[model samples]
Every structure is written in structure tokens, then in C-alpha cells.
Target: MDTVEVVCSKLVEDADKWRAAADGMSKAADAAGGLAMGAEQFGKIADERGVVSAYAPLQQTFTTLASGAATEFAKIADTLTLVAETYLREDQAGEHAMRRLEDRL
Candidate 1:
């Protein structure tokens, strides 16, 4: 037979780590948002070769990518937190059941 143990504390710790990463990504998103705003400045009609339209396309792209990544990371962190809490509750219930069984025996 094989045995396995689920450490709820470790899951919570991992969730914290995911949350930190999400925060970092959110900061990056904010910075990218500033860049996105700046990108609008490049859409002038300076030359016929379209040299002035370089960064205008990125007026929404960079911010969207970074923001999406941050959102996904946050979701991962929330899922880990939920899993940890659920496992902890289940473990406690199982332990209580075993104690009752032992007391009756």
C-alpha cells in the first residue's frame, strides 16, 4: 500500500508565493499602462513612410498583456488558498471522526 499526506500549511505558503507573483505582475501592468499612454504620442504624420506610427499600436497591447498575466496569477493564488482551506477543514473533520471512533471503542 502507498500512503500520501496533504500539508495544508504548505498549500497556504504556496498560495502566498503566487499572490506575491501576482502583485509583481500587477505593478508591471501599471508600468506598462503608463507606457501604453506614452505610445499614443508616436502616431503623428511626420513622414510618408509611416515612421511616426511605430508605437501607436501598442497603446493597448502591452497593458492588456501584463494585466491579463496579473489576473491569471491572482486566480492561481486564490485557487491555492481555497484548496488549502478546504484540505484543512477536511483533515480536521476526519480527525474528529477518528477520535469519536476511538472513544466508542
Candidate 2:
């Protein structure tokens, strides 16, 4: 039971870290999109026709992929938190029942 608690605690900690990482990923995606848009306005070469236009699809795709990855990370974090909470609840309940039986004995 002690071991289970320790494991659950670790799971919760990992979940928190994952949540933070997801936030960072989302922020990075936003920043990247902004940079790409800015570049499209200022970084065009005359000879390289259609180069700026080509970047539009790439930027959109990158942003979409990053957003999806962040969503998955958040989902995983939520799942881990739920699992840890459930385990802790069950452990406490079992301990409580055991104590009651011991008292009767």
C-alpha cells in the first residue's frame, strides 16, 4: 500500500509536468505561426516567385499539428491524474475497512 501510494504520487507529479509541457508546446505553436506570418510579409525575394505563398500551407499544417499534439498531451495528463486519484481513494477505503475489522477483532 505504501508502494502504491508512492507510485500514485509519482504519477501525479508526472502528469503535472506533462500539463506544463503541453502549455509550452501550445505557446510555441502560436509563436511559430506569428513568426511565419511576419516572415511572409518581410522576407520575400523577387526572383523566388510563389515562395511566400508556399509557406502559407506549411505554416497552417505546422500549427494544426502542434495544436493536436498539445491536446493529446493534455488528455494524457488528465488521464494520469484521474488514475492516481482513483487509486488513492481505493487505498484509503481499503485501509478504513481493515481498521474497522481490526477494531471488531
Candidate 3:
């Protein structure tokens, strides 16, 4: 669980960095000359690219989070399953012991 939390935190940090990169890209584009399509097309592409780039980070974050969560959940599930099996075996043994005592009486 602690590891999961750390991974999640790291993913968030990466997301922030990705966002900053996209923003920087947008600003640089804005500072450059007008679009070749008489300004309108260029402006549109720039705006669209900025927005699209912004989502790129979000998409990456989602993918990372999802994959990590799945892996962690699998591990947790395996642990729980092992615990359950152990308890079940113990219970079965106890039941058998009790039955044997009853028969001896």
C-alpha cells in the first residue's frame, strides 16, 4: 500500500511536469509568427495543439495510474487469498480435532 501511494504521487508529479511542458510549447508557439493559413489556420492549429498536448499528459497519467493500480491490486488479492486459504485449512483441522475428541468420549 505504501508503495502504491508512492507510485501514485510520482505519477502526479510527472503529470505536473507534462502540463508545464505543454504550456511552454504553447507559449513558444504563440510568440512565433502568425499561421501560414492567413493567421486563422495557424492560430487554430496552435490552439488545438496546445490543448491536445495538454491532454497527452493526462492520458499518460491515466495509463500509468491504471496499470499501477492493477498490479498492486493483484498483489493484494494474492495476499488475501493466501491468508484465506490458511485460515480455511486451520478451521478444517480444528473441526477434525473436535470430531475425534467427540468420538473418543
- Candidate whose lDDT is highest: 2
Kindly list the per-residue Cα lDDT of model 3 for residues 1-105, writing each as its tens digit: 554335445555555555555555444444332222332534666766675556546555555555555455445545545555566667679889999999999
* Best-fitting candidate, scored by TM-score: 2
Give per-model TM-scores: 0.77, 0.81, 0.43
Clash statistics: count for each candidate: 0, 0, 0
Alpha-carbon shift of residue 38 in model 1 (angstroms): 6.5
Go through the candidates in order and give each one's C-alpha lDDT. Answer: 0.75, 0.85, 0.54
Error of 3 at 61 (Å): 0.3
Candidate 1 deviant stretches above 4 angstroms: 1-6, 36-48
Local accuracy of candidate 2 as per-residue lDDT tens digits, 29-64: 897678665344746573267666677788888888
Model 1 Cα lDDT, one tens digit per residue, 1-105:
322135766777888998898898889889877764332454434434564454556746777888888899889989988987887778789999999999999
The parts of candidate 2 lying over 4 Å away from their true place are 38-48
Clashing pairs in 1: none
Q: Which ten residues in a row have the lowest lDDT in candidate 1?
A: 36-45
The C-alpha RMSD of each candidate to the native structure, in angstroms, is 3.6, 2.6, 14.2
